[model samples]
Target: MKKSLFTFIILAMVLNAFTACSSKASKGGGAKLKARFEVAGMCSNYTFSVIEGRINPALVEASWTNPQTNKTYWKAFGISNPCNFPSNIKEGDTFYFEIVPAEKDSKCAVCMAFYPTPGKKLNIKVVQ
Candidate 1:
């Protein structure tokens, strides 16, 4: 009886572990969005602007509206350590990407000069 009880407990623990892992994987694991690499200028950190998908408004740190066209641009900074921006993609190239969390100690060096980019940045990875 004790052996059966132990086996049952082990099975339950394993099932629980799998359930937790699956939940974490699906929570923030599937947010691919389409964007174009629009370089604002030399000083801008976020050059990838949304082209075909919507980003969480809360993640938008900076935005610009073109008065003539009435088009709005959204920008987010990409974390470089874990995510290396694709080299083949050039300015104005459209690509798919997903938002990711920046590491606790991650940092990107930049100038203090003002640039037309969202002050808020969301770590993102280029998805094929």
Candidate 2:
């Protein structure tokens, strides 16, 4: 009986150790998520569309090109050039902006959002 009790104690200890290790792993497991992409270059009422979205690496870099009209949409993201704001895109111009995600699918959803800009507000699918 004593031997059996000792074995059980040993088994319990082993189980507890495994459980603790698993808990630690879980605490450090998942990848970091990034913020969704959005632009307010167009009318506050109009919404921008995501042409293509894929994870490149740690940084999410996206540029816009008006497919239908053959124009650049850098200003949509509040940038003028590759590293400039307004993207030199004038107001009321039909532009396309590629929305890139920060982190991968482990966390953030590949979604889009638009903040109201002056007279026009970008359209969003949200109920509210």
Candidate 3:
């Protein structure tokens, strides 16, 4: 009976460890940047043509105007499908969003092609 109880305890601990690991992994074990942006316009190849070569024309270009500095910071999202575009947002609308690296130092060509200009290899999600 003692041996059986010991085995059961060990199994329970293993199960708990697995559950914790899986939950953390699914939640994206990383720090995410949360910010708000005012949609400036849709990004096009012409926008990045000189700076970073041709790019995915479907990207959304947005900017955050710093209240303190009164400067605007720009970034672009690689969301290509028009259907996936957030229904609540429109051009010139300010929205909250989060940016997380797709992977550590991930340099996705399609997403990061406009580097040094306005694009980066990160996953962006609207925060509703």
Candidate 4:
């Protein structure tokens, strides 16, 4: 009786572990946002523009106005600064991605050139 009880308890734990792992795997990595690789900058710096998905205003700092036309446009958080381009993705390729805030300690060596319409510095994780 004792041995059977122990075996049953072990089996229950193993089943629970398998169930948890499978559930997580099925969920995939959260919602993916569609974006297009717009350009590559010096020092491996890359930028991606949002192709689909609602833009979050909080992620962008300021709006730009075309003086000639007097038309103002608000840049959304979709513009991101992903310093390193993904191995398989190239400029102009539309792909799905998730924006992850850069860790406080994360650091990258890049050129000092100023890029116009600078994007928010965040980590971009490409989703297949």
Q: Could you give candidate 2's per-residue lDDT for residues 1-128 as a string of tens digits?
A: 99999999999999999987665433322222222234343322232322333222222224445444555533222221212223344334343333222232333222234434222112112111
TM-score of 3: 0.29
Predict model 1's lDDT versus the native. Answer: 0.60
lDDT score, candidate 4, position 32? 64
TM-score of every candidate? 0.53, 0.25, 0.29, 0.51
The global C-alpha lDDT for each of the candidates, from Candidate 1 onward, is 0.60, 0.35, 0.41, 0.55
Model 1: residues with Cα > 4 Å off, grouped in runs = 1-29, 65-83, 105-114
lDDT of model 4 at position 92: 71
Model 1 C-alpha lDDT per residue in residues 1-128, reported as the tens digit of each score: 99999999999999999987665444334666787776544443445566665455555535765333455666544333323565687777888877666677756465656445444455667886
Top candidate on lDDT is 1
Clashes of each: 1, 14, 0, 0
Residue-level lDDT of model 3, residues 34-75, one tens digit each, is: 333333232421111111222233333454343443555554
**Model 2 segments more than 4 A misplaced:** 29-128
lDDT of 2: 0.35
Q: Rank candidates by TM-score, best first.
A: 1, 4, 3, 2
Alpha-carbon shift of residue 90 in model 2 (angstroms): 31
